[model samples]
Target: MRLSSFFMPTLKETPTEAQIVSHRLMLRAGMIRQTSAGIYAWLPLGYRVLRKIEQIVREEQDAAGAQELLMPTIQSAELWRESGRYDDYGKEMLRITDRHDREMLFGPTNEEMITDIFRSFVKSYRQLPLNLYHIQWKFRDEIRPRFGVMRGREFLMKDAYSFDIDAAGARRSYQKMFLAYLRTFARIGLKAIPMRADTGPIGGDLSHEFIILAETGESGVFCHKDWMNLDVLKDAPGMEDDLQPFFDRITSIYAATDEKHDPANSPVPESDLVSARGIEVGHIFNFGTKYSKPMNAVVAGPNGESVPVEMGSYGIGVSRLMGAIIEASHDDNGIIWPDAVAPFNVGLINLKSGDAETDRVCAELYAKLEAAGLEVAYDDRDERPGAKFADMDLIGVPWQLVVGPRGLKNGVVELKRRATGEKEELPVEAALAKLLG
Candidate 1:
């Protein structure tokens, strides 16, 4: 993708309302536009990152045996009524009345709707452990919506529902999601600590929110420092296998959100009471029969007795994560996206755009990088070198390749690592090999 053709509307000034770092950078980068209060229209560049994150979330969930499905944004209020949450959910639920005086709503969460769906088709314990997930937009009527996508009223979410035969089965399913969430966050270059949280409106005593520490975070968190050292990839619990190891992995570290952080019975040493502000990017809950029982989602047990299927819901903020990643990985320059989640893998800069020699060399390099299956954004615009460099840094592509008449004449191009701010001059082929290899 060339900058001249890209739809990014890079700004010269930050929007007044964007107080948080992630929100400010997103606006300055021209990634998103506010369509309404707390609602945004993702521009080309923002949508690219959004889709990339969603794909990673999908891959990790699938690996954990959760199947993907699409769910509608608008759901009939009758579903919420089934669980007696229509009145209990409060104004946070975006209630609506149809033209014919029928009630409708933009779902804040899919627990009720998913339960209705599960009850309609799934019967008997023969298909006991089933997990279904969907990435969809949700609407919540936040009284004071702010902080850009971080606390948007309308946002994307990946919610997965797990159905199992018993409490034991539900715990195993929760552990599977627990492990998957750890891996999912790690792959995006985030160290998300799973902390126990208040169930809130979700109504589950068993819940954990995957949180990343940032000064801009919305919630307070306390945790042992050891969570930073655990690696899900190495400590593979094979999510489908025994969950005891999975349970042990999380138990090895003590973590909790402020609401559930019990100081009286705390396990961590007072010296290790590392408290920080954190953003909740993902949440999972083991709500045994919280939905199934209320909605009558029952299954026949081996003894032929009717039993409510235990349920759990797992979530990854499909949109909020984009902002959260920016909060964690960015610097004064702009967003330093994790290489795994960047809209593009590399930024190819041509110092003298349209200059015969410079153009020839950059075109070849861009072609080579693209042919190697890399997502490279070539800065092929007729802009000043200073502006080109600033824009490149602002977008925070992992690697930056600089081609100029002087450098190309010397048979080398300058390469810069966005994360390290390190620069190297290497032969074109050497740079290509190092970057693409």
Candidate 2:
């Protein structure tokens, strides 16, 4: 991508309405724009990051044996009514009526609809332990939607539904999702701690919320200090393994949101506890018959008895994660995107764009980087060096390669790592080799 023709409309000043660091940085960096009080229009740069995150979530879900299938944004209110939650879901659900006077709604979640789908085709226990997921837009009419995408009313989400024959099978599915969520966050360069959380409207007895600690988090959290040292991918069991032991070990780590924390009753010593603010990015629930029984989503058991299939729902806030990442990773200069989720892997800055030598060097490097399967943003505009540097930093590409007439004359180019602010001067071949490696 060439910055000279890019559509990024970066702002020089912070918007007054942005109260949080993520919201302010996103606006100033031209990643997103507010279309309404709680809705945002993701621009090109932001959309790239969003899609990257979504793909990560999808990959993890697939690896955990969940199949992908998109669901509609508009849901039939009859389904919600069948699950006994149409009215109980409250004002957050955007209830509507079609021109023909049939009730409809923009779904906040898909428990009811998914249950209905399962019952339509799936019959005996042969189809047990099935998981289906989708990445789609969701809406909740928040009374006070603020902080950009963090608490936005309209946002993208990945929701998965798991169906099992019984409680034991359901727990297995839950554990798989638990491990998958941990791996998903880890791959995205986030250390998300799974904390016991309330099921809320989901009505589940067993639930966990995957939270990443950030100063700008919406809620306070308390956890065992050891959670920071744990490497989920290294320690977790395989997909086909008996996950009970792994699940037991993780749930015993003593993490909790403020709503569930009891300092006096906590097992961990005060000294071993780490209290911090955290943002919730994913949530999983094993709600055995919550939706299935109410909606008659039953299947024949081994004993030939009809039973409600145990069900679990997992959800990741696909859009809110962008704000969370910014909150956890940004610095005074701007966002410091993680390598896996960066919009562009590298930003090629031509300090003197009009200079033939500098432009030639930058163009060559850009071509090489792209040929090596890297996403490169080449700054080819006739802009000042400082402005180019600032814009590169603001957008948070993982690396920045600086080329100038002086550097070209010296037979070297400057490379900077965005996260660490480390710089090195190396020959063009050396730089290419390092980047390719």
Candidate 3:
């Protein structure tokens, strides 16, 4: 994509409402725009990042033997009523009434709806262990929405519901999701610690919130300092199999969020305890028959008796991750996007857009990078070199290739790594190879 043709509205100064670095940088970088208190309109660049996050979520879910499906954003309130959670769900639920006075709501979560779907078809124990997932928009209507997408009212979440006929089986399903969450966060360049969390409105006896350490985080957390050294991706397998050992390896650690933290009973010694702020990015829950019993999500058992399906729900904050990634990866210049989720692989800067030699080199390099199956953004505007360089760095596209009169005269171009700000002067061919390869 060419910058001149793109819809990025780069800002000269930070927006006043943006209190956090991620929020401020996102606005200045023209990634998203605020629509309501917590709602945002994701622009082209923002959408690209969101889609990359969705892709990673899909890959991890698929690898964990879960099937993906699309669920509607708006759902009937009748389902929630049947589950006995209509009034139980507080103000966050955005309730509405259509012309006929039938109540509806933008789904905050999908426990009731997913339960209805499961009970409709699978009546036998043969289909007992099914995990269904969807990546969809949700509205929670936060009263004081702040921190941009991090605590947004309307956001994207990857929620997976698992059904099993027995308690032991349900626990195994929870472990499967536990392992998947570790792999998912690791892929996106975050070391999310799974700490026990209050189920709150989700209403599950068992829950874990995957929190990432960030200075602007909402909740306080306490854990063993060793959590910083545990490498999830380093030990994950390439393909799915029995994940018992993987699950065991992570669950062996001691971690807890503020709600669950108890210093007296904690495993970590006082000196090793690391107390800090953290952003909750994912959650896993084992709710037993909370939704199943209320909604009659029952299945025939091996003994020929009908029983409420033991259940679990898992969630990953899909949109909020854009903010989390920035919080975890950014430096003073701007957001340092992870290579896996970067909007573009390379930023091709034409130091002098109207200069024939510079334009020629940039155009050729841009085409070559695109041909190599990379997402490349070319700054082909008749803008000053400083402005072009600043915009490219602010957007954090992994790499930047500067084709200027100086480099052209020397048969070289300047390549800069967005994450490290490390520049290398190399022949155009060498730079292209390093970028594309």
Write model 3 residue lDDT over 349-406, tens digit each, in one string: 8888788888888889888889989999999988998899888889999998888998
Evaluated against the true structure, the overall lDDT of model 1 is 0.89
Model 2 lDDT, residue 381, Cα? 88
Model 1, stretches more than 4 Å misplaced? Answer: 262-265
lDDT of 2 by residue, 1-437 (tens): 99989999998899999999999999999999999999999999999999999999999999999999988999999999899999899999999899999999999999988888899999999878799999999999999999999999999999999999988999999999999998999999999999887889999899999999999799999988888788766777899999999989888888888888888898879899999999999999988898888899999989889999999999999999999999999989899999999999999999997788887778888988999899999999888999999999999999999999888899999999999999999999999889899
Candidate with more favorable, higher TM-score: 1 or 2? 2
lDDT of 1 by residue, 228-248 (tens): 566646767676588787678
Q: What overall lDDT goes with each candidate model?
A: 0.89, 0.93, 0.89
Candidate 1: residue 252 lDDT (0-100): 65
Q: Which stretches of candidate 3 lie over 4 Å from their true place?
A: 233-242
lDDT score, residue 240, model 1?
58
Q: For model 1, what is the error of residue 164's alpha carbon versus the real structure, in angstroms, after optimal superposition? A: 0.8
Highest-TM-score candidate: 2
TM-score of 2: 0.99
- lDDT for residue 256 in candidate 2, whole number 0-100: 88
The collision pairs in model 2 are: none
